[model samples]
Target: VERRSASFALRMVVHIVGDVHQPLHAADGVDANHPGGDIGGNARRFLPDCNATNLHALWDSGGGRYSLHWVSTKPEWEAMRAALLRDARQMVQNRTAVAAMDPLRFASALETATWEEAVEALSMSGGFGLVRQMIGESAGIAESEVFVGLQMNPHSFGGPLPCPDAAYFANAASVSTQRIIVGGYRLSFFLRHIAARLRRQGLLVQGGDNVFFGVTNAWEAAPNAALH
Candidate 1:
């Protein structure tokens, strides 16, 4: 294995863990199988009038929208981000497919969320063992490469420097920033809201406060971007 820089490796490891946590990423399904055209979350329509597009895209980008200019202070946003980060960290540390699958399915539907239901769901014990295992194996390789790269170059690839030209990086950086702000936690909130709203419709948040898709492959039945 190549030698990698510690900082570079840490970030890569963090990202790799997140990627594997997403059930869709673990899926080997055929895109053509979905009735919706695969627009990467842009094709399918979700409710709430806020985001009415593809599921994958919402999961990928919706986290940023939650903290939009709607809030006046960055502190509020940071607080929410911190809480989310904590929940995410817990999810990674104690991931359980069975415990997570129920809420995962509920969230996948894009329904409304409520604290009452969230509290109830958090009491179950489906578990994150499989999630932890996969993350451990996959994230390691990615981090090694990232750290090794850092060792080879003092200037980070995205860091300011004799790195890539600014124009070359502009679009990529913008998108990356967008994901950090609008993805993950934000998306989780939106879906939880949707689930709470649709609770009357036979949808319920399962497990204990976790909402990961494919926690048990139930949401795998939902429409995909390619299906649009």
Candidate 2:
């Protein structure tokens, strides 16, 4: 299984690490009334300047493009990446305190939601263990944290319906940025651990420069609720 070791594992990690950082990608709109969940906010609709139309769609585009559209070309991606890097730089400066936050602690807090989803068995070992934990945290954020005090349906409806304004989009973007930062920190947690093990085996995984960074906290202990 040498082919499935190290390099392959690293590739998979890269793909999924970006995913877990996306608040909406990891979330599900849920409540006491409809305990079954809103299928990751697909059940809700809103207008976010662009025509993407749903709550999930807005986040799927990274919330920077309020005018709902996809990043389909290299040029578009480059522009978006530049904006993101700037935001990330500023975020790092502003939240220098986030360095103390623990990804493992956050993972456990998110796992509290797994019992609600009845996935404890699947969350048993290896990749399933991490997936279960990450997705649980994602759902935890989706179920309550992202809504920002707005009213949403507690029952079976898709939304309270977003009659959104400028402030709403701004808050959405802010939340998205925070989540993305946390995602990078979490990715580092895995690689750094792997590096420690590799060092024991007389190997090293090297990257360039002083590219090290930190993390922010998971949602505050508000009964483990979240929204997308």
Candidate 3:
């Protein structure tokens, strides 16, 4: 692939992996109200007073704490970047507190997996096993945490949707935070794996201290370098 295409592919992988870490992304509600499915909770509305319009939006925004809006200006983008960095620092600092909330023990597995073990697993399963495990974990969380306390309206429309209590919001925030951290870790692993594969395939070359992937200049000099 061309340099730009490879970069875009990597970004898509990162984005999709991060999204899959969210419980709602891997699960949907199916009940008498809507037999087809809740479309990952998008069909179920939350109370008007809630920060999000629907169940999926609530978790997507990190329980209203990390709602993101368009940044049209450079200053706005800078501010958002700083805020994200701050939040990431805080999450890393308090990651241990959220460990108990991760029933799948992904953090532990990531920590213990050696390079050889990871490569072996990836080779054997073509990385599908890891992806499946992550999805399964998210689905389990969606069932036990996201869908457990929800009170569905008897009628699909014309009535106020059930409002999640403060406790639910708090728990959701914690779970979201944990998932974000896990997603970051997983993304890092995936990028490293991709880089290794590219190097092995002669698609990436080591230039000084930086690895250039099918590109002449340093990858850091690329316009989208800030994403890293």
Best by TM-score: 3
lDDT of 1 by residue, 104-131 (tens): 3434323343555443443233444333
Native-vs-model 2 lDDT? 0.51
**Best candidate, lDDT:** 3
Model 3 lDDT, full chain set: 0.67
lDDT of 2 by residue, 93-191 (tens): 533344445444534433334342323333454456655666777767765556665446523343446444556667776766666666654554454
TM-scores for all predictions: 0.29, 0.56, 0.75
The models' CA-based lDDT, in order, is: 0.34, 0.51, 0.67
lDDT at 29, model 2 = 59
lDDT rank order: 3, 2, 1
- Candidate 3's C-alpha runs over 4 A off are 93-128, 154-160, 200-228
Q: What tens-digit string does per-residue lDDT give for candidate 3 at 1-228?
A: 765666677667766777887898999888777688989988888767767788888888777667546577999888877777766655555445645655546445544566676655534456556777788888988999998776786444635477888888899988777678766655555556576666666666645433344333212222122122
TM-score rank, highest first? Answer: 3, 2, 1
- The alpha-carbon lDDT assigned to residue 29 of candidate 3 equals 86
Better of 1 and 2 by TM-score: 2
